[model samples]
Target: MPAPRIKSPALLVAESGADREGHGLRRTLGRFQLVCFGIGAIVGTGIFVGLSDSVAQAGPAVVVSFVLAAVTCVFTAFAFAELGGAIPVSGSSYSFAYAGLGETTAFLVGWCLLLEYGVSVSAVAVGWSQYVDELLHSLTGLNLPHALAAGPGDGGVVNLPAVIVIALASVLLVRGVRESARATAAMAVLKIAVLVAFCAIGFVAFQDGNLSPFSPAGLGGIGAGTTAAFFSYIGFDAITTAGEEARDPRRDIPFAILVCIGVVTLLYCAVALAAIGALGGDGVGDRPAALSHVVNEVTGSAVGGGVIAFGAVVAIASVVLAVMYGQTRILMSMSRDGLVPRVFEKVSPRTATPVAGTLIVGVVFAVPAAFASLDSVVNLCTIGTLATMVTVNIAVIALRRREPDLARTFRVPLYPATPLLGIGFCLYLIYETGPATWFQFAVFLAAGLLLYAGYGRRNSRLGRGGDQGLTPGDAGRVRQEA
Candidate 1:
């Protein structure tokens, strides 16, 4: 068998342009919408659901952990800015890898991205269930039965609400990107409003003593919490997945990525300070509905708690929409490269979206959301995302060296130094994730390699002597659409 060739950077750009103009996905997103899409994705379960665990692990110093994680995310966000400006393609780091590294490496990156997006949606759904249950109990003094609300490990039959939320998000995505983006924007507004309320009400009862001995768990604990907190920032890259759908992708995608990072970081820090200041680390960190719980404790208002719960539900739903949208697009990109089934690349003429692909992805994760305990998936999402970030940082440097003439709408401010630090921080966070995550990451890669060897390697379009050739299945689907 002939070895698959590395796709040249110029060829990758050309193919992306072709995909835009030739019976491909519509470009309906503007800069503001892109920014909204990003914020909607970035500010979800990690803040509402995951923050308590982070505070527990790091004590009052969890605020420091939030900063540490943001700093780590900022470094990678810079790398993503440069690459998104230059590439502006749907596959994100996977496509960047193909342009700089080769098919094998890109395949592995894409596979990890699959895990990152899938597990992330499942995890977010699980968090959504928590908030929904909270809201129900607060409003009516009734909660979901344990068997219906909890995952198996939690001694439940299935998380039925989690599956329902995933299904609803999938339906919105199938309607079209414009509708999805609008929904996301509305939900993003609600989410931000709720956080602002939380911060405002929480400060009224702030106690300096609560923040005493801030680093009770010390540097090691902060490091551990930073790893967990990193999960909050994972959805920023989901912005890059919408590159082909953006009106001025080269300019808008990069700008949106960095802006999303700044906005989300500030919100995270503010909320962390509010929760810990109002009730202390132990008081806020050890509970499931910590943020809402803090608001109730501080203001003594059950209605405020219900409002927060409602906001959290919206936040998680927005995340589900964004992440699911990202997953389908990435799969579509890989399919266009002949690394996966071509059906994923087929867009519905009626919706201008990948309907068939979207349904498949939604169903795949919804099952897990229904029956699985994905609390552990949070660390897995962090590790997989950090791994992708490492690759993206390397891709930026490699592209600069190999394609210096490529016009980038945005460039990394400090060049090699920034990308290097991005890589370093990602590695540090990966280490903090510990040996178990490393083993899981390795096993995932091993499985990807096996799948690639069995299929992707043999069927790659570049190997077949074509650029963006539709598979037989895709060809028939296009004819029908035409």
Candidate 2:
């Protein structure tokens, strides 16, 4: 039999090593842009839409759930920062797996990420509909028709606004990365300002009685809530997907990752506290629009609710932009490796953007946002993310052993402890995702394996021995000085 193929770490490094000096895509992002990407990716639906579900699950102790999720994210974020600094590639966990494990493992990670980012974009798009409908109702005294404003499960024939927003984001991304980053930064500022306004106003109306029976469902409830709240932290890894575009991938990627996680964690904890305190946990759950409901309840005014609804609409757009951006870049990376079609890897000479990939991603998620119920997509994303987390932590440890001499801009503290705990926490969350999710995930994995067998394994660049170990290329003129 022919030797079983495995993508060596050297090959993985060579692929990203070619990223310097404008090998394929344009490098336009700085550290601030990177931080905004994470913030934009993270602070949307989970707070504006999903918070109510978490509140319902844990009562007032949803605060504990947010904290638990943040702590877990911190562990995984450290591992990601370390790996991203070393490899500095667009594939995020997929690239990390390819370097530390094998090609098969890398393909599996990429497959999981495809679902994670694509469904997340759709889920956030569906979330945007909630706020858009609320804003319209507040201003025009008319709600969008159920058939046009919601998915079938939510009693609507289709979600028109969700599809519209995805289409708009696709146009923006096709324009270029700098343009997308600028828009993301502007929206990030607007959403953060709105969230601050909410906290400020909510504190004035805070009621102590609302916190009574804080852990209404006990520890089990808090654990369950953490599973949902964890979704809030999903986009921090999107920062790592910009390694090729980053001005200084090693130093900036790690810094941006840590900053985004720290800032978002604090914001989430505060928002959870303010929301439960102002509206009461029970009052917040299942509300058609959670943040708007909180503002309306506390201020006794519809204007504040209207303002919040507008901010949420913008926030969800930023999320769609950031998440879709991450997805397309990951597809591009896989394509360059010959794991997928070369069309995905094609960059427009004029725009330096992946036009085909961006359009395809937009269309793929748009269909789901237009018709499918996405409550399941959120859980599916969490399951995929936990799996990525497990691989990332292991990749960190493996890289340390394999490349002791590699220059690292950041390292996970306490060595094996951080990654080990990261693995343990990810597994715990996987268990909490329930049996139904596992079955769905298994189906998804099986589909990915079939695709790999049919196409990827044969066409992979490593299989053909092309630039597998950093052979001189156009990008070799200006090497990164480590």
Candidate 3:
């Protein structure tokens, strides 16, 4: 016989030599550090730049859209909470799906996450560049040449600052998670501070007239804005990726995910309301209708706009740090599972961090950051990530059926109903974003599927009795069929 494939219903990829051989490391993460990671990742992307985009799409009713986004995330967060408690692994739901669904399904989940994380880094970096460029002009009255500051479509050869930020973030990831979380926390604070300032300054000039055309595009605008604003919920899932490192993942993961989503939604609503109040509801939607310029009209000086701009810069810095951090961990998890090159699985002995894995991820983000558009990249990020959330909702159902006996630290509050709602909401968001974004998402997912067919299927350690090294109870871990 050529071979009798040892099919594992669970999607867990058995460890290969690359996994066990490379890590003789230690654990350094605690609840506080992990919380910082959640906060860092959650705070950046929307506040810095997407704020204008959401405001434009939803009009002043973007606040209502934010509530919708938060509500949707809460439903999924419940599903994630259940999984984090049951399967405290890195890869988030990708790992959970492997153990609950099957290898093929797990591969898809992992692929979706990679799509989310990879494109997210690019989106964050591009946003960071915008802020950095503005901060530079404000601080020194001399900014980078427009050619260097922008992407090709914007008349630039390369986005120098975006690449630089991505490069720096990669270096930080290679160091260790704790060190990274500290930096992220600091940046998160500055970003939030800037936003609070926006609220204060923008509110002073608030006019009742701005709320007149609350839904300029009608209720459809609110729906589209809610869909567009789903981008803000992307980073909350970063909470679960740290399951292994968290001091009490069951409690911490659920808490962080929910808290981050809630907090971020509040921040986004504040910024949206303030911008609409000062800019007449439809103002500050696009680059030409920029948030800073609108603030200038009300505050009468660049100081207010400068503060928000500065905040955007600081916020994006943390985003690059946090998203890059999430990206490295996802690769490390896959590496340990034999889905990718072994070097990516290697963790540093001194720092107990995935140094090699982070370096490779760094290179991936830097290239795109050097060339891509902030708007396109961010939307592309949403399609893939929202797809992953869809999978998590599915995985929640699969696991309930497959492993009812498994310990769950936190259960989805409404069982099947909650997860189903999550799935529906995610799909709706993807639909409103348009067909083009989905096209890119499809292309990226197709690439991942090809990689899995060509490499993952053959190299999977479970196909080789490689996971027998796991603890006795964990021996049948990946094969617990539904």
Candidate 4:
């Protein structure tokens, strides 16, 4: 359906109230830094923790899954580039829906965004715990007890490291965005470096035979693998949320989205292929193993794997930083619109960061990380991101028709065809996720809808969307409309 062009007062993107203008977060990050953030977010979990699940779901066919998943994202990535360029705001899909699809859709999109960034942050925390435990056991021959290190799914009492990581990231977010991004970029380099080293070491031990029987379950297996593989791709989209803060939204943002995805995909494929090569099929190396296990098996030395485990620890911190930063930004956008409570939008006067929102979101992630099943939450995160991408694809088409003359700095190529392909890819993955994911998503959306109707609808600036308050660009747009 074509979305209505929303000239709503609520849609005037509020200042990222924390930063100073111009030199502020508004277009401050360059392409390289933006790409690093994307990599920082993408390279961690999908490689370190998610690989086992990808193997379980798709077996040797996971390589196929990676390709399929990357294909799907490439389509959606194009649409995101276009939309991110047009709107260039922090809300990501929420802001996109506001301008192109109106307040209600914007509300729901914001809710889904919450699911994508928030739950994913929790999931990353769970992943963080696993690596921390791995590092401890290998280095010190002593580790946190199983209860404190593992999640419910793993029959552990709690994931304390996960909680701690969340807490630490919260502090950084409260510090500020640019500061957090720099820290995350440094950690991201370490994570990639570790993985690259592992890949190089394992590559020498590669056996060509492992490539045989690649598609054990054929396309079905590969499809499942692709869906599973897609989980790692989540962080690349989060980079789009930095649109408002980017130095050049029209050029840099699109490059970041695509370039980041490309970089991560290559890394994942290399890591997966290298791991499989170093360990034979049905080997203990392929069992319910952390990434360190694969490294250990190939090297015949636990020390190398121990280093990989340490690398995993660094990777998790990077993941938490990128994911938490995305979460706070989206919430800031929501708070500004009065959809969520207003206090969340408050920026720290000193750091110019949304300290309150960061703390709240940090605590929210901590709960699940401290107590919930990592595997289960990971699935939830997958569904939320896929669902949002579907919305982005739909919104891309809707906006093009509704505002034909709107200055789109970057447009999705091949007319509607590219985004339509993106929509199809997104839906297939959504279906591939099957019923349980759908059920959870339904409950999440329903709950969000209830909140929207009860609070957001009444308080929405759209209903009385008369120029109440606006900055210069926003005021100009309003006057032009009037």
- Model 2 ranges with Cα > 4 A deviation: 1-10, 16-19, 472-481
Report lDDT (Cα) of residue 142, candidate 1: 95
Better of 1 and 4 by TM-score: 1
lDDT digits (tens) for residues 204-306 of candidate 4 = 8899898667767778878887887888888787787887677766577888898887877888888888877777544412343356898787778879888
Q: In candidate 1, what are the lDDT values of residues 1-482, reduced to their tens digit?
A: 85536776556656666234554777889988898899998888999989988998898888889898998888889888877877777888888899887899899989989877888999999999999999998899899999999789668999999999999999999999999999999998889999999999888888999998898888999998898788888889999898788888878888899899998899999999988999998898768878889988877877899999999999989999999999998999899899999999999988989999999999999887888775768887888889998998898888888877766778898878988998999999999998998998999889999999999988898877888543554333212211
lDDT of each: 0.86, 0.87, 0.73, 0.77
Candidate 4: which stretches are off by over 4 Å?
A: 1-5, 8-27, 284-289, 466-482
Ranking by TM-score: 2, 1, 4, 3
Better of 2 and 4 by TM-score: 2
Among these predictions, the greatest TM-score belongs to 2
Residue-level lDDT tens digits of model 3 in 1-482: 34423222222333421112233433355666666677788777666677677777878888899899888888888888777756656778677677666666777777777667877888777777887776666677777888887788567888889888888888887777677777877887777777788788788988889887788888888988887787876787877777666655556677677667777778888878887888775567765325667677886877666776777777777877888777777777777767777887777888778887787888877888788787767777777778878888888897788667666667787677899999998888888878888787788878888998899877877665676565544435432321
- Model 2 — TM-score against the truth? 0.96
TM-score of each predicted structure versus truth: 0.95, 0.96, 0.91, 0.93
Model 3, position 152, has a per-residue lDDT of 84
Best by lDDT: 2
lDDT, model 2, position 342: 90
Model 1 — TM-score against the truth?
A: 0.95
Model 2 lDDT per residue over 1-482, tens place: 56545554445556655345666677788988898889999999999999998999999999999999988999999999988887777888888888787788889999999767988999999999989999998888899999999989888899999999999999999999999999999999999999999898888878899898899999999999999999988888999999888888888999999999999988988888888888788888867679899998887888899999999999989999999999998999899899999989999988988999999999988998998775968898899989988999998888788767666778899999999999999899899989999999999999999999999999988888775455554223223345
